[model samples]
Target: MTVQDIRAFNRFYTNVIGALDHRRHLHAPYTLTEARVLYELAHSPRTDAADLRGELSLDSGYLSRILTRFEQDGLVERAPSAQDPRRRRITLTAQGRETAALLAERSDQAVGSLLSAVPAADRARLAEAMRTIREILSAGRPPRGEDIVLREPVAGDLGWIVQRNAALYAAEFGWNTDYEGLVARIVADFAEDHDPHLERVWIAELDGRPVGCVMCVRDEAPATARLRLLLVEPDARGLGAGDRLIGAVVDFARGVGYRDLVLWTNDVLAAARRLYQRHGFVLTAEKPHRSFGKHLTGQDWRLNLTDAQQ
Candidate 1:
C-alpha cells in the first residue's frame, strides 16, 4: 500500500480511537469477546446458547468454556431451555449486569469525549467517512444483497417489532424495560385499533424477514404527528432503512393533513440525525433526560409539511 494510505489508516485507526479503546475501555478483566457475550446477556434476561453462538459466531466449545467461567464467578447462569431440554440458555447474574454496564458506560464516555473534542465540521467529515467505509465494505460483502423495500406492518409483525426494538435498544444503549414498555404500549394500541388513515407502521424486510420498523402516531401535544418506535436492526442499519422509514413517515404525515412532524431521539443516534436532516427535519429544542441507568441528552426535531417533497 502507499505510504499515504498506510498513514491515513494509522491516524484514523491506531492513533485515534484505538488508543482510547485499548487504554480506557479494554482494561476490563474479561476479554473483548467475553465482554461482548456479557453484553448480549445483559440485554435479554435469557438467551439461548445456540442463539448466542450464531449471533456472535462463537465456537460451541470455546463459548461454553467462557460461560462456565462466568458461571463459576457468579456472573452468569445457564438453564435448560423450556422448548428443548437439550438446549441451554444463558443469562447474566446481578454482578454480570453491573459489570457490563460499567464497561459500556466507560466505553461510551471515552468515545463521546473524544468525538466531542473534535471540531464540529471535522466531526461531520469523520462521521461521513466512517459511513462511506461501511458502505464500501457492505457493497463488497452484500450480506443479504441489495436494498430492501419497507412495507406497512401486518399481523404478527408487531411482535417482532417489539422484540427487535427492545433487544436492540438494550444491547446498543443499555436502554431497558421502560423503553420496551413504552414501545409495547404503542404497538398494542395500534394492533387493537389501528387507524391507517391517521397512523402507519412500516418495516424493512430482507430475505422476507423484517429487519427494521418505524411508526407514526397522531400527536396530542400539538396538532402535529410524532414519529415513534423507529428502529433498524444493527446489521441492517447502514443500508438506508432509516432514511427510507423517515421519508415514508414524513410523506404519510403530509398526506394525512398534518402540517408538522416531531420526534425525540438520543444524541448518540448520529445516523438518525442525518436521515432527519435529509427529510427536512430541524432541531427545535433539547432536554436532559436520564433513562436506562445513564444520562442522555435528547433533541426534539420538527418537520414542517407544508412544503412537501417532490
Candidate 2:
C-alpha cells in the first residue's frame, strides 16, 4: 500500500472510532489517554512513571502533567519502591478502579456496536484483516521477553492446543491425522480426569495468543509425573518459551511432591530432546515403533528431581 492509501485508511479508522474526540468519557469527562492510563494501572501488578512513559511512548512532560492531574483528582496513589527509593510505584485507588472498569465496559460496547454494523459474514474477515495488519507491522520489532506469560488454560484453549499441535507437526514433520487424533484423546482425558492439586496444564501466551503449552499429569507410578504434549509454535521458538514451559512443569512437579518426572517423545524431535536434556532429564530407553503412519523410534526420558537437588 502507498503512503497515501495508508494515511487515508488511518484517517477513516480514527473517525470511525471517534479517536479525535478529546472530551469523550465513559463515566466522567476524561481524555482517551487518561482512560488508558487508568486501565494500565488497574491491570498491572506494579508500574512506575518511567515504565508507563516508555510503554505508551508519551513525552515526559506530557506524561508528568497527566499524572499530576490524576493525583490531584484523587484517582491514583504513589509510594516509594522498595527496590529503589527514588522511583515511585503507582497504583489505582478504589475510585480509579471503578473508573477503569467503566471505561473498559464502554470500550467493549463501542467495539461491539461497530462490529454489529458489519455484515455477519464479513466480521470474521475484518478481524483477520486486523490481525494481518498487526502482524505485518510488527514483523521486525524486537520481542520483549517480559511480555511472555504462562497462564492456566481457560475455555477453548484445549481445542487450540490440539489444533495447533496437529497443524504444526503435520507441516514440519509430515505427521498424519492419526497424531491429531491422539492429541485430541490426550486433551479430552486431561480435561475429564485432571486433579487440580496433582496435575496441571499451562498455556504460554505472547501478544494474547496461545504460543505454547505443557502439561504435568500423574503418571502410572504414584510418585512420578509425566510431562506431555510439550509444544512451542514455530514463530515463538528460540524465545525461551520452551525452557519456561519445562521449568514450570518441573517446579510444579517438585512442589507437589513428585519424586520423578518423565516424558515420551519421538527421536526425530531433536529440539525437544535438547530441551529435556538441558533441564536434567536423562534418556532412559528407546524402542522402535510403527505408528502415526511412520516408523518412529520412541524414546523415554526421566528426571530424578530428588537426586538433582542434592
Candidate 3:
C-alpha cells in the first residue's frame, strides 16, 4: 500500500475498532498489547524473545516490562531457548494458557460480532484484503534509529552479560562450560567488588533493549585498563553497534586516566579485529593455544592513550 493508502486504512480501521472497543466488548483483563502478546505465544511455535520483538515490532524495553509483569502474575515463564540458548524463550503457564484461551475466544467473538453485520460474501473480501496487507508489509522488521545508546547496567543487565557471553560463544564457536565459568568469574569479580570510577560497563541499547556490551576494568599491569567481553548480538550487527561499543570502551578507558587500553581476542574474530584496528588498537603479540575446546591463536591488541587524540 502507498503511504496515503495506509493512512486512509488506519483512519477507517481505528474508527471501526473504536466502536467495537475490545476492552469494553471483550470484558477481559488483558490490555490490547497484553492480548497481542498472549496471542503470539498461543499461536507461534517459536518462543525466543529476540525473534518475538522482531515479529511484533515492539520496543524492547517495553516488551521486557510487559514480560516481567507477566512473570510476576504467573502468566509466563522465561528460560533459555532450546534452539539457541543465547536467546531467551518465553512460555505461558497453565493459568496463562487459560487466560490466553479466554482472550482468544473473546477476540474471535468480537471479530465475529463485527462480521455478523456484514454479508458473507463481503467477509471473504475482507479476509482477502487483510491477507494482501500482511503479504506486503509483514516481511520487514521495524526501521532502526540512527542513534544507538550506551548506558550503565541495570538490575538484570549484569547477569544478561554473562549468559549472552557464555551461550553466544558456545553456539558460535563450540566453546564449553569452561568458557562459561571464565565469564562467570569475570562477571562475579566485576559485580562483587570494583572501583566504580575506574571500572565500568556499557550496555549498548538499541530500540530500547540491550544488543551489545563492553567493559573497561583495571588490568594487572599498572596504569593499564583491559577491554573485555565485547559482544554484539548477530541480528544487531552491521548497524555500528560494535563500533559504538568499542568507542565507548576507549572513551571510558581514556577518561579514567589509563595510560594504555588492552584487549585479548582470538584470531578467528576477524570482524572484531577490524573494529579494534579502526579504533587505533595495534596488535602487539599472538600465541596459539588450546582452550575453549579448540586450538586458537590468541592475539593481544593495545592502544597507547597519548596517541589517541580523537
Number of the top-ranking candidate, with TM-score as the measure: 2
Task: Kindly list the per-residue Cα lDDT of model 1 for residues 150-228, writing each as its tens digit.
Answer: 6555557999988888888888888878888888898999888866557878787764568888889888766689998
For model 2, the stretches where C-alpha displacement exceeds 4 angstroms are 1-140
Per-model TM-score on C-alpha atoms = 0.52, 0.59, 0.55
The C-alpha stretches of model 3 lying farther than 4 A from their native spots are 1-141, 145-147
Error of 1 at 87 (Å): 56
Q: What residue pairs clash in candidate 2, if any at all?
A: none
What are the per-residue Cα lDDT tens digits for candidate 2 across 176-294? 99999999999999999888667878888886688999889999986999999999998888888888788778766765579999999999999999999988999999999988888
Q: The CA-based lDDT of model 3 is what?
A: 0.79
Q: Candidate 3 lDDT, tens digit per residue, 1-310?
A: 4799989989999888766664455535666787788776654434578866987899999899989988998988888865577888787776776777677566666777888999998977877777566555746554353435566676789999999999899999999888889988999999999986678787877655688899889999999999999999987888788887787677556645789999999999999999999889999999999998999999999999866244
Who is ahead in lDDT, 2 or 3?
A: 2
Clash counts per candidate, in order, are: 0, 0, 0
Better of 1 and 2 by TM-score: 2
Clashing pairs in 1: none
* TM-score, predicted candidate 1 vs. hidden true structure: 0.52
Q: What are the RMSDs of all candidates, in order? A: 18.4, 8.7, 16.6
